[model samples]
Each structure stands twice: as structure tokens, then as C-alpha cells.
Target: MIVLASQSASRKAMLDAAGIAYEAQSSDVDEGAIKRELIGVPGGDVATILAEAKALPVSVGVPGKLVLGGDSLVEVGGRQFDKPVSREQAAEHLRFFSGQRMNLHSAAVLVRDGITVWRHCETARLDVRQLSDSFIDSYLNREWPAVSGCVGVFRIEALGVQLFERIEGSHFTVLGMPLLAVLAALRAQGELEA
Candidate 1:
């Protein structure tokens, strides 16, 4: 079984649905500090760094077991967006994202004994449909607190799908992790059947 270093529902659901055994553990990493430190870095690389940060700390405690960490970020119009802090903020973000191309960067890392053994980052491009104020209000009314945890202010597997007009990338990537690459890495590590 792998040790998961996040409480994110999407990542946990992905592993659970894929039949990957894992135990959820919070990494306790300070994400805001890391993002400040990584100013100007590419979104994909930032995701990888955050993933590694989460994994390395957790791996130190569980010496032999593989610890999996994952992170996702959203970049639209050269601006990086964090998870919205409020319903109003989410609405503002939705307005900014309207009719814009959003780049979603999802990354994952495998660490054991404080050493990273594998890392992967994938990017998904989503063309957000033009959003009207009424549409944004209605969308957030139903999706707010739930999507508040999402970097893109949306979740692809749920009502969030309505926000996109076109998407060009792996479905798993848009869900917040590069799950295929992660499964492949697990197979390579002998954690999963080859």
C-alpha cells in the first residue's frame, strides 16, 4: 500500500477508483510560502515542487513505504490562480477565466525514506466558455464551498465540466493529478503488478 500525502478528495478518489491501495496522511506543508518562493517559475514546475515538498516530509516518517504526493495549479492569461477564498472571489476568478484558455498543471511524486524516486507533471489546456454574470452566480451557488478547494475553481468530474468549451489533455490531468504516469511509476517501483 502507498502512503498518500494529501487529504484531497479528487486524488484519493482517483487512487481508490483505480484499485490502488493507500492511506491518507496530511503533509502539513505550507503551500503559500512555497508559492511565494517560486515566483515566476512555470506552473508545471511549481506543481512538481509542491508535490515533492509534500512527499519528502511524509516519506521521512514512513521509511520503507512509498509516499505519494500530488498538486495542481491553474494558470490563465499569465496569472496563476490559487483556490478561491470566498464565493465572491470564486465569481471574480470565473469572470477572469471566461472565454480564456486555462492551463492546468498537475504533478505527482513518489518518495521513500525522504528520497524522491519518481516525479511527473502534466498540463491540460481548457478553453473556458464565455460566462455571464447570472451563469457565474448560478454555477457558484451550487459549487462554491465544494469547489473552494479546487485550484481552477472547478472540478472536471462534476458540475465544473460545464465551464469548459474544449479541453486538450488527459482527463486525469484535468482532475488534478497525472494519474496514468503515477500508475506507471508505481508499476516500475513494484508497488503494482507489471
Candidate 2:
């Protein structure tokens, strides 16, 4: 059976929508600590490292089960934005993203029997329309609770799509799991019927 080492509702929803059978378990790894340790690495590489870190611990305990772990971040210019720590922070993040194009990096690792069987990073570019202060405030109030690791202030599945002018990437990657790449990896490993 496939085990998903994350508590992300979006990831679970993606897996379910694809009709993939899997078990969900929260890895509960200290993500802040991992990010801090990887501070010296490039932002994209940091995302990959964080995903592997999350998957490895779960894989070690599950014996032969295949475990999937994922991490996503928003990178603009050179800075990486982690989850917002407060409403104010969320608002600030939205302001930074206003009228700008940014990159979203969603990285995943699939581990089987304590070894990484496949890995991928799905990068998508999003153009945020010019947003007013009031819009930012309202969006933060409405979306902050639902959005945790999301770099942008809005949840694309919800009202968040309205905030974007254009999104150039796979829909699944923008959603956070990159389902196409995951499917390809699974098929190659003979874990899924193609």
C-alpha cells in the first residue's frame, strides 16, 4: 500500500481524485528546523531537501511500504517565503506578490523500503494582478486559516484564482503535488497501471 507522509488536504485530495489508493499519516517533522539547516542552499534545492527530509523519517519506520513526501515554496527574486506566521505576515506576503510574477516550486520524493525510488520538482510561474490593500486584507482574512505552506496568500482552489492574471504551469503543480510527474514515477516503478 502507498503511504502519504503529509497532512496536506490538497495532496490527499489530488491522490483521491486520481483514484489512487493510499494511506495518510502526518510525518510531524520540524520543518522550520530543516529550513534553517538548509539556509545555505539555493531555494529550489532547499525545497527538494525538505521533501526528502520529510519522506525519509516516515520511510524508515514503514518497512516495505512506499511513502510519498512533498514540500512547496514560493520564490521571488532571491527570497523564499515559508508559511505565514501571522495575519500581518500573510498580508505582507500578498503585498510583495502584488503585480509581480513569481515562481512556485513543488517538490516530491517517493521512497520505498528506505530508499528513494523517484523524485521530482515541478516549477510553475504565476502572475499576480495588481491588488488593492483592501483586497489583500479581505483575502488574508478569508484564506489565512486554510492556507499554511502556500507562498501566495490565496488558495487557487477557492477564491484565490481570482487574484491571478495568469498561471503558466501544470494545474497539479500549482495545486502542490504535481500529479502528472507522480503518476509517471509510479508507473515507472510498476506501482501504478499506466
Candidate 3:
């Protein structure tokens, strides 16, 4: 089993559905500080940095085990977005995103003994359809709080699908991890069957 350095439900579900066994450990990384430090970095690079930050500490603690750290971020019109702190902010974000193309960057890193052994990042493009205020309100009414923990204010596997008119990328990437690449890396490292 590997160590999963996040408490995110979507990550857990992805691993679970893939039959991957992992011990979930919250990385406790200060994300805001990392974002502040990475100001102006591309979204994918920022995600990779965040993923490494999360996994490295856990890898130190686990000593011999592989630690999987994953992170995702949203970029719209050259601005990076974090998880919305409140419903109002989420609504505002949706308004700005209306009919805009959103770049969702998901990244994952594998580390052992505090050394990163593998890393990957994937970007997904989601076209946000024109959203009327009533539609936004209705969507938020059903998805708030739950989606509050999600970047881009979405959980693609859920009602968040309604926000997009078109999506171009791996489904797993949109779900917030480069899961196929991660699984391949695990197999390459003999953590999973070849």
C-alpha cells in the first residue's frame, strides 16, 4: 500500500475505484503560502510544485513507503483560482467563467524517503457554457459547501458536469489527478502488477 497525501474525497474515490490500496494522510501543506511563492508560475507547474510539497513531508515520515501527492488548479484568462472560500465567491467565479475556457491542471508526484521518484501533470480544457444568473444560483444551491473544497468550483463526476459544454482531456485529469500516468508510474516502480 502507498500513502495518499490528501484527504480529498475525489482522490480517494479514484484510488478506491482503481483497486489501489493506500493509507490516506493529510499532507497539511500550507497551500496559500505555496501559491503566494509561486506567483505567475504556470498552472501546471504550480500544481507539480504543490504535489511535491505535499508528498515530500509525508515521505519523510513514512521512511520506506511510497507517498502519492496530488494537486489541481484552475486557470481562467491568465488568472489562477483556488477553491472558493464561500458561496458568494464561488458565484462570482462562475460569473467570470461564464462562456470562458477553463484550464484545469492536475499533477501528481511519487516520493519515497523524501525523494521524488516520479511526477506528472495533465491539463484539461473545459468550456463553460453561458450561464444565466438563475442557473448559477440553482447550480450553487445544490453544489455549495460540497464544491467549496474543489478548485474551479466543480466536481466533474457530480452536478459540476452541467457547467461545461465541452471538455478536452482525460476524464481522470478533470477529476483532479493524472491518474492513468500515476498508475503507470506505480507499475513501473513495481508498486502495482506489470
Clashes of 2: 0
* Predicted structure 1: lDDT: 0.95
lDDT of 2 by residue, 31-104 (tens): 78888887767766777888888898899889988899998888876678887877888888888888888788
Which residue pairs collide in model 3, if any?
Answer: none
**What is residue 184's positional error in candidate 2, in angstroms?**
1.0
Runs of candidate 1 exceeding 4 Å displacement: none
lDDT of 1 by residue, 1-43 (tens): 9999999999999999999999999989999999999999999
Cα TM-score per model: 0.99, 0.94, 0.99
Task: Provide the clashing-pair count of each candidate structure.
Answer: 0, 0, 0
How far off is residue 50 in model 3, in Å? Answer: 0.2
Candidate 3 to truth, TM: 0.99
Off by more than 4 A, model 3: none
| Cand. 1 TM to true fold | 0.99
Cα displacement (Å) at residue 59, model 1: 0.5
